[model samples]
Target: MKQLVILAGGKGTRLKDRLGDLPKPMIPIAGKPLLQHQIELAGAHGFGEVLLFVHHRADLIQEHFGQGSRFALPIRYITEKEPLGTAGAVLAGFDQLADRFVVMYGDTMMNVDLTRLWSAHEQSGADATLFLHPNNHPLDSDLVETNAEGWVTTFHNRPHAAGQFFRNLVNAGLYVIEKCALEPWSHDRKLMDFGKDLFPALLNRNAKLFGYNSPEFIKDIGTPDRYDWVCAQYEAGIVQRSSLATPQRVVFLDRDGTLVKEVSAQGLHRIEDLELLPGVSAAVHELNQTGLRAVMITNQPVVAKGFCTEEELQQIHNKLETLLGREHAFLDRIYYCPHHPEKGFPGERPELKIECKCRKPEPGMVLEAQRDLNIDLANSWFIGDTTTDVQTARNAGVKSILVRTGHGGADRKHDVAPDFVFESLPEAVQFIAARSTETSGE
Candidate 1:
């Protein structure tokens, strides 16, 4: 049986109106306490027991779910004498935690699949695996950067430096921690935090930290507006539907001229040349709010063409993510095909001059996305600015929306016609949203 540790010590001062005299975790969500929702989700995902760390109003929490028999899991409590920060409180109960335990904030509304997360933790063999996700407000949030292997490289806290474009990966306040990683700091009683203090220290010491990047639903309902919005999302079924445990309906987007301006056929090699089309941000934001996971599937042959390296291509995408973050939009993931079939180009990498299945007009990228994201292609759509995109969608057995943005169907390379055509991504999203509404009605 696995164990979960929840930090339920928040005083709820920000949510005073909703809390009354109850603790923050006791705030109502879907006619039950927020902690109840966490517990239920944990139980569904193979967490057989829970260990709650409490400080403020501990009695109320203990009184509601004593022994956890009703919740179908054994419950235990470790009451903290003072308001130690997130890491401090967890470290305070160092001896009580299992060898490897999952930690969740009691204030957040999350539907993560603990079984899947635990599996990832086991496979990676990391000292700590932090559950990270992209959010719309990365500008104001503490950011975490992971390398190509999904290992933690940097932690960028709030008050981000100006003009620096970072990936929109934010620490979503969920973790799978190995207790041995905390033994060295367990004796220090100072008020420490995870993102702000502890994580950076771990990285400084070359700790084996892994980041599990996901597109799942995890949001903190700390403030009144956030609480209201979370409650609305819960009632609308977005909270549960957004989890990775179930199949997701994705809106696969073409990068150039669809998400950003297309400079040339070879693709814009310089990061400065990147510019997003009008209404792109708002439309993507709508897809996010309406429960459609937006994924970008682009064909960038620049790496094979010698125009730019893969590193440069990543920075360009990072800039795109930063721009979208400013407008409160995020992509679930970005998949691109960098291999070019044609050979004998000057300064080209001979190794990459081979035909790859992931190229556009082939079903490789979409198929890979289908597997990685558990996407339901029959109910999904591919919005692009060219005929090849429509052809790709047709090949993948998904509905296609051709936008008149970049090529606007000018290229006759592919004879396939899209199921629908729109002036831009915004209009296409609107039509798709309406169609979703109609389908839900049935």
Candidate 2:
């Protein structure tokens, strides 16, 4: 029955170029808003009630998740007319919080076991416990040096301070704080941040502020590259997603190479060349029987290059559906990117070539499929034959299996590496199906 407060008020300046008008927390990752994933994780970790501190575009947050009942957790929102620093927002929302609670950053993603954190905090009897991680890039973080017993002895926020400390533990942006620690601040104070003001003040008073070292999967999506990295991790299955029931997983397929024989760039021009690879239909049928969705994510630059029309693409898909039906295998959804680089051809529109987020090597298409189809990126795997496909799965945070039939075998020698490699689509499918059964204890 722990209470949680999520600080989701930032303007997300770093993600503005990619996200446009959307708030940072609302940015989509694997089809759902980042904030939704955080909330769902909290619910899974046993947090019964949550308070979202929102400032910019608060309406969007409220609109998408009214009361949080759908996620099986009670939720409330606290809006601020003006930007409140981290500590200020917490102080303003103090009335809603209980005697003790956990505070987390909405823009960051982590698979932290909060139960362990709570237990550690209680055992130490500290006023606050800061979740800490080993600082791989200490130059760009607020570094902390802790004693053997985990009591933080020194804090440094600059690169020059690196050699001075004996350890490299940095704050992980998650904290468990007792209400009494925040009593010094007045709710109306205009500027106050935990790292800059509050924590220093606590140290000055010789308060018991401790660090809990748990180097779990933690990431801060503060910039476009980092946001992209987080998406890749989600696609790769490195990040665990919250789920009920048997924890359903998905299988993402590449249409061109693995599903059908390689159509020489010229031959792929018509529906006649589109054919399912050996055993592909039966493999998909087996996944369907097990309640797994077989989704197709592809990059069809042929449309952007003027080799085929959108109508022609639909016709090709129609032919695929007809073929799958003959073998009793159905595609749950098909996502394609029609954009090509601006220098694709003489007739290619520069606008189409302009860096689109949904292109392969980007997680946009797969993420859109996840959102529309409710596929779990963490538990799912993408099977493709090209390095671009591998990069796409890496960026989306899903595990990848390279099948030799398409560009997979060639991709094995490429710069990007996949988690698994198979000689053909059927081989990859058989491996994943067997692994799924083992995971299910069947």
**What lDDT does candidate 2 reach at residue 37?**
82
Name the top lDDT candidate: 1
Per-residue C-alpha lDDT of model 2 across residues 1-442, encoded as one tens digit per residue: 6898999887799789977878788888899988888888788788989999998888889999999989999999999777778888899877788888999988887776777778889999999999876433544667676764789877877554312322345688899999888877756557788876788788888889988865355778999888997887667554553221223477989888888888785437587777788898788777654545677888888777777877787768756755665576666556788888757485565556656888788899888876544567898999988887888888999999887776655654347888998888778888887887677554
Error of 2 at 74 (Å): 1.2
Off by over 4 Å in 2: 161-166, 241-442
Candidate 1 Cα outliers beyond 4 Å, as residue runs: none
Cα lDDT of model 2 overall?
Answer: 0.77
Q: What TM value does model 2 have?
A: 0.55
TM values, all candidates: 0.98, 0.55
